[model samples]
Target chain A: MTVLEARDVSYQYSVGTPFQITALEHISFSVEKGELLAIIGHTGSGKSTLIQHFNALLKPTSGQILLYGKDINETKETARDARFKVGLCFQYPEYQLFESTVYKDIAFGPGNMGLSKEEIDARVRRAAAFVGLTEPMLEKSPFDLSGGEKRRVAIAGVMAMEPEVLIMDEPAAGLDPRGRRKILEMIENYRRQTGSTVIIVSHSMEDVASLAERILVLNHGKIARMGTVDEVFSHAEELQNMGLNIPQLTGIFTRLNQLGYGVNPLTYTVEQAKTEILRYLHKGGAADG
Target chain B: MENDSLIKFNDVSYRYESDTDTPLPLAIKNIDLDIRKGEFVAVLGHNGSGKSTLAKLANAILAPESGKIFVNGMDTSDESLEYEIRQTVGVVFQNPDNQIVATIVEEDVAFGPENLGIEPKEIRRRVDDALKSVGMYEYRFHEPHKLSGGQKQRVAIAGIMAMQTECIILDEPTAMLDPKGREEVMKAMQRLNKELGVTIVLITHYMDEAVKADRVIVMDSGRIVLDGTPRQVFAEEETIEKAGLELPDCAKLAHALKRSGVNMPSDILTPDEFVEAFQRCVSGGGVL
Candidate 1:
């Protein structure tokens, strides 16, 4: 089922002025329920603006945004409903964490929905648990925690909303290897437990390859490509030409495939690369070497 | 004091004071290290591993509580030499916007030298040279806020260059940038380090960036756990993991291949190096 859809979306940044600019032109895509999608592009690729349109945070200057077959902007109430149904998380977790305590910060979103007091408490606890936050952490100031922990609190705030679709921007930005891995795992586990559609915007091609089921590549505010992992990453040159990157490790295998080694070059993860390289070497791939 | 050393740390230790009764652990503990002149050294560690603290200690931004740090053989603890120490060892932090002051790019670069009371004519020359070095000369007249993250970061580096600092310490300068921005900033750093003979101490979590350095330092629990050339340090795959870091993608692949009885080298850090090693191994050459 399509949880969100963008039909012929076009947006202008500065309308009717000398500096008028079209940020998005004829953009069209539909997000399926329970799918993990990643939108990738350079800094000015209209990714943020495009995601804003999904949640009705910004209405398209032309065209319609649909949530479950209904236009999100059909009425003010529906627009507000789309916002609650699609959770959009911005980068820099600290900016989103303003409440005094971690618990309050997590509770703020659910509280805004006018849920029952007990229901809100239950959702807050569940969200905190989903993000791996401890019991004592709830009483402390979110600002006082470590960077990783602060980010968890911010994630919990969004997860507490229990949106049908969870969208995060650069969820693992600025984290070390362990922390980065943890965020990716948390994103995965959250999707598994909740069965919610997940969308993330990222710059790390490696992370996107590992986590995302589908990739949406944007360049100059237009969709350059949208496909499965293999479909998108297969065209490394095109992606690279658009100021993007592929996993360097994958590049090696891909280059070998191009050189007639006949090795499977579609894999990006380490486990798959190891198997493919081992298979090639064992099969007397030594001649071309 | 070693004559070739630009920044030397001798048994240095520092801990932040806590306002509450709870005592805080040392941010950087008993670190004895030396960065020689004109060397590109990259420091890697997880958050709170004292990499930033070490950078701060080098520039006299934070005084060591136990030992001493010398920039050009001048003690960092000395109050009178603070200005001189900072002048010699400049720092570019992770967020470029925080360090940039002026609206225009050239003015932001000139802010450093201008504050030092340099004449306008000389300042203009220094500013232009610095901007050109970072490949941001064309953007010099543009507003600093309008430039991309990588461009803004290069402008910040130009600011330090205008001061003519002999050494620079950068703390995850590319952490917030995209791939292209990261490439731009990394290129500028390399150009400055190689062309101008400026010593570079970069604190980063990116393994690929660390591989380009002359030396790689790994810190853990406020101590230097590993220190060697990129090849030497990355060879210790187990130690890197214990330090809360991971091997570069190629290195990890090599390790996996070796575990599966393939003859790939365990120290491959980059994709090109991996491709080269894989070819040699497949050619039935002796294990390297």
Candidate 2:
């Protein structure tokens, strides 16, 4: 089922006293239910602008977005409902945590949805658990929690709304490796439990290679490429031309291939590379041997 | 102290004013370190672990409550050396948007030199030189906000480079950037260190970035927990894990392989290294 679809979306940002910048132009893509998509791009590639359209945070200048087969901008009331259905966790979401306690912060979304007190409490607790925030930590002041904890709480706030589609923009930005792993694991677990469509916008190719099932490459405000991981990563030259990099493992494999090694081009992750190498070794080192 | 030691922290200990316990919550504790001239040192630590505080201390943005800090032989605690310290070691913060004061790129680059009261002609020369060093001279006429995050960050670095300070401390300079932005900033730092002989102190969470530095310092809970070369520091996966930090992807894969009884180098940091190691293992029939 198509959980979210963007048809020829375009966005423009007014600049200076007279000029306007076209951030995105005629971008088209559709995300299916329970699928994980990653958007990769350089700094000015309009990945942020495109993701903002997923939740109706920014209206498309020329196209339309449909959530669950219903046009998001069909009506003002529908757009507001779209916001609840598609939860957006922005980059550096910790800055948005303004509530006193973590529990109160997580509850804010459910409360805004006009859910009952019991439902709000239940949602808050469930969201907290989804993000790996312990019960004791929920009652503590969000300001007192560490940076990673604050981030989780901020994500929990959005998850409490029970959005059918969750969008995170650089969710692990500025986090240590362990913190990054923990948060990504939490996200994966959340997806498993809820089966919601997840979109992660990140610059790290390794993260995208590891987590995302489908990859979308954005360049100069257009959909440069979109496909499965193997298909997208196989176009290493195109991605590099757009000032983006493939995963380091894929880069190494490409280099090896250039050096006359017959390594598989479909390998995107280190584990896949390892398995391929082991199989090749077990069958003798030569390609045809 | 050695003649070339640009910055020295001698048993420094600091606590925030808000904490009022018997032994206050130490922001940085028992830090005895020296940064030599032209050395590029990377500091790694989780958030709230006091690495940022240590960066601030190198420039005397925050004073050690109990110990002494010296910038180029001048004590930081002395009021007379305040200007000298500020002029000696420049700081670039994480948020480029917040640190940039001027609307235009060239004007932003000129702010540091202008504050130093350099001649107008000299200021222009230094601004041009700084922007050129970071490969941002072409965008000198551009507006700061119109630039990409990476470009703005490079402009911020140029602002410090224009100051012509002996040392530059960047606190998570790539935190707000994409991968390409990070590569650009890291390359700029390398150029400044190699070509200009400027001492570079970078505080960051990315292990891959830390690997490029000459030395690595890891902090946790306001103390220097680990300090060594990147290989030495990262080899201690236990300590890294205990500090709530993650290893680079290559390192993690290596560790995983080791756990599965594959004999690979634990110090593998890059994908190339991992690939080479795996190839060697295969040749030796090490893989099951």
Candidate 3:
């Protein structure tokens, strides 16, 4: 089932002003329930502008957004419901964290929903646990925590709402490899447990290659391409020309194929590359150099 | 005292003092390092690992509590030489929004040199030169707020370059930027190092970025745990793991291929190298 759909969406910044600029134009895509979709684009490529329309954060200047077959902006109640059903975790969300303590910060979203105190407490604890925050950490000032910890707390704030469709922009950005792995794993676990649709806006081709079931490529306020991970990444030259990158491993395989190596050009991960190389060697390839 | 050393840290240590009930941990402790002239040094560490503190110490924004720092020929601890030291060492912080002060692009790039009391004519020359160096000369008339994150970051770097600082230290300058912006900033750094001969000290969490540096330094628990060329440092998997880091994609794949009884070279740090090595092995009859 389609969880969210953008029907010919178009957005303009500062419309009617002298500096008005088109950020997204005639973009159309539908996100399925329980699917992990990765949106890849260069800077100023309309990835952020497009996602904002999903939760009614920014109404389109020309088109419409539908959540579960209902127009989000059709009425006030529908728009509000769309906001609750589609949670957005912005880039550098840690900066938005404002409560005195981590617990209070995570509780902010649920509290605004008018949930009972006991229900709020349970949701907050579960969300914190999903992000690997310990009980003692919830009591400490969010300011005193490490940068990675503070980012997790910010993500937990969104998770506490238990939205059916969670969208995170650049979720693993600015993290070391280990930290990136932990955060991505946390996101995966959350998706599995909740069976919620996950959409991530990312610049890392490697992260998208590994995690995303389908990928969307945006360029200059337009949908350049949208397909499965393999399908999108197969067009390496097109992505490079658009100022976007393919996974590093894919680049290598593409080069190898160009050089008459005849290797599998669709390889995106390390395991696949390793297996392909081994298979080539077993088929009478030499090691005499 | 080394003649070639542009910056030196002699047993540096720093700890933040907080009045809150919760105690703050030491920011950096017992560190010693030397950055030679015209070298590109990349610093890698997890958050709270004292990497930012190290950047602050380089330009005398934060003095060492128990050690000493020298920029070029001036001691950072000397009050009389503070201006000279700051002029010699420029720092570009993580957040581009915070560092940009001017509404217009050219004006922001001129902020640093103007503060040095340079004449207006000289400031104009420096501003034009800096903007062109970062490929932002076309946007010089544009408003800083209207520019993308990458464009704004380039403006920030140009601001530092206009000051004619001998060395530039960036504290996770690309942390908040998208991939394209990150690439733009990295290319600018490379140009500054290669064409202008300016020393660069980059602090980043991305291993791929670190691989492009002339040298990589890994810090943990407020101390330098690993320091070597990118190839040498990334070759040690155990050390990287202990320091809360990981090998680049190429290096990890090479290691795994080697373990799987494929003839893969161990020093592969990039995809190009990996492809070349694999082609050689396949044609030369390497054991499977």
Best candidate (score: lDDT): 3
User: Could you give the CAPRI-style class of model 2?
Assistant: medium
> For each candidate, what is the lDDT?
0.88, 0.86, 0.89
Docking class of 1: medium
What is each candidate's fraction of native interface contacts (fnat)? 0.63, 0.59, 0.74
| Model 3 lDDT tens row, A110-214 | 898989999999999999999999999999999988888999999999999999999999998878777898999999999999999999998888889999999
Tens digit per residue, CA lDDT, model 2, B181-210 = 788789989988999899999999888899
The digit string of per-residue lDDT tens for model 1 on A79-122 reads 99988999989876666688889999999999999999999999
Q: How many angstroms is residue B232 displaced in model 3 relative to the true structure, after the best TM-score fit?
A: 1.8
Report the error of model 3 at residue B234, Å. Answer: 1.8
Q: Could you give the candidate ranking by DockQ, starting with the highest?
A: 3, 1, 2
Chain A, model 1: TM: 0.97
Compared with the true structure, the alpha-carbon lDDT of candidate 2 equals 0.86
TM-score of chain B of 1: 0.94
- At residue A168, candidate 1 shows an lDDT of 93
Off by over 4 Å in 3: A285-289, B20-23
Tell the DockQ for candidate 3. Answer: 0.64
- Candidate 1: the clashing residue pairs are A286-B282
List model 1 lDDT by residue over B208-273, tens digit each. 999999999999989999999999999999999999999998899889888877788787888888
